[model samples]
Target: MHPELYLSYSSAFAIGLLGSTHCLGMCGGISASLSMALPVGRGFRFRQTLLLLAFNFGRIGSYSLIAAGVALLSTQAAGQWAWAGLLLMTLAGVLLIFMGLSMGQWWQGIRYIERAGAPVWRTLSPLTKRFLPVNNAGQALALGSLWGWLPCGLVYSTLGWAALQPTVPSAALTMFFFGLGTLPSMLATGYAAQWIRSIKSHQGVRKISGILLILFGLWTLPIQALLNL
Candidate 1:
């Protein structure tokens, strides 16, 4: 891959790893509930693991799908407007900064961006109920696919970054890797809810993650390139 594309993917995965505290707040409940819903029996751990994996597969699949859709639209717009691509990159950088601030509990302005997605979530939320009380991996998968649409500033921030990719597939892959970064936390949540919760609530970890993300956002901006020119 080109160095820039590699950097984009790496940064996206880092964002997912660093911002997973937000993920815990958003999707961890459902993940834990999936475990609790399953009956304790022989092979209980296996079943729980299967269901969680399925759920996350579906969730990550949805993220890639959304990224593709957004990249499709953005690429078309960029084709017509010379400045559209740059605008998207700038927006992505700003969103990342906002996300970092929110992650650190320094500011919550990203909540407003999340609220912008509420209407979409409202339309999709009811569908999740149909898959509740998940009995099988398929049901869990369906539920998770739906849950992925939940209004979230972290997801939106990453989506903005994904949109700036040159191609739809690249954008989708960006999100796919990002989802992978969150897997450790999501998987651990079902097995060790308290431990995961404590990590989410740890102020020191959050602050360090926030500062790294802020630096990343600044690096993502084109200011340095403009200055060099």
Candidate 2:
């Protein structure tokens, strides 16, 4: 996999920036709930920040793991581009479209894919309970990791790109970077997500993101051409 091409910063940044909206909707309640778990005190802000970081660390870790796994699996297709690459790219593109729709909350059925990982989510979900008090960073991190399994289109996109990787390391690295790409906005959303989501609501950002994903799908063909058929 060409990291330079497969996990370009532009795409990651776009996903990250647009993904802020999702952060507001998906993680807003969870983060707020974690905040409530904090002990009451003026210094609670510090505790909240730590909790936020832990949550993001867990989420990013999960994204990286999934990305790597998908990429590793795709390695089986190396040198078989005529069939495998075509199929991978096609599925990726289709997934991207569905994800885009799902992100906008315009389509719900696509989330059925989340069921594929449900058993794993079930295993991790229990860890969140241990953080009932969430009085410290460790528990926050655990809860975050547990929450990382939450269904998400952006995460799916990262995994989709990973599945396009020619090797496991490349796939993982690509997604790590992609996860890194999403950090700023998501972090900010954790803080000011309600306002951000409200502002974004009236805009056409979702529609534009969907179109951009369509363009990304089209971009795959030219990329394959550059890969020398």
Candidate 3:
């Protein structure tokens, strides 16, 4: 199976970025809340920062596991890797369309599954309560990890794309990068994401990002056609 160049292609560096416009709300909201919820103290800010890093670390770890598992399954799938490319293309196209609609305010359920991860989030979230009136950095970090379990469609879609990679390690790395890519925006929200969120409207962000996703989908189509994927 030829998993070269496009086979294990990186999506905009981090596949997660493509979904940022939509994720701004759910992830953004949670981050803002987490930042505010930190126990008040001179070290609150410092503790909050560590909390964010830890949360994302756990989150990316989970995503990597999922991506690697999928990649292993795909790595061995009947190949020329046609199915892999086809699936990526399909997902890209669907995401582009849905993101486009979502950007225009046509729908809001795109984030529903992100809530499904809430069961885990709920279990982990209460653990954060133990740290309230926030005493130490470790507790804040644990809080972030608990919140990181948040269900996100963007994360799920990116995992699917990574799974399409023929090599499991590449898939894991791809997800790791994707997670890193998202860290900036998410972290910003954690500390001060509200400022950015205030300036830009989700619809505006979605419309613009939606177009980018469509172009990405188009780019994948040619690869699919070449492979007859």
TM-scores, one per candidate: 0.96, 0.81, 0.73
Q: Candidate 1 on 38-114: residue-level lDDT in tens? A: 88999999999999999998999999999999999999999999878778878888889999999898999999999
Off by over 4 Å in 1: 225-229
lDDT tens digits by residue: candidate 3, 8-109: 445635445656555566566755666787778798887788767766676677667777877777767636555556666566556544544554466655
Q: Number of clashes in model 1?
A: 0
Question: Model 3, stretches more than 4 Å misplaced?
Answer: 1-15, 39-41, 79-85, 104-149, 200-202, 222-229
| Clash tally, candidates in order | 0, 0, 5
After TM-score superposition, what is the CA distance of residue 95 in candidate 2 from its true location, in Å? 1.1
Clashing pairs in 3: 39-134, 55-144, 55-145, 114-151, 189-193
Which one is best on lDDT? Answer: 1
Candidate order by decreasing lDDT = 1, 2, 3
Q: Judge candidate 1 at residue 192 and give its lDDT.
A: 90
C-alpha lDDT score of every prediction, in listed order: 0.91, 0.67, 0.63
In model 2, residue pairs whose N, Cα or C atoms come closer than 3 Å (at least 3 residues apart or on different chains), thus clashing, are none
Residue 41, model 3: Cα distance from true site in angstroms: 4.2
List all candidate RMSDs to the true structure.
Answer: 1.4, 3.4, 4.3
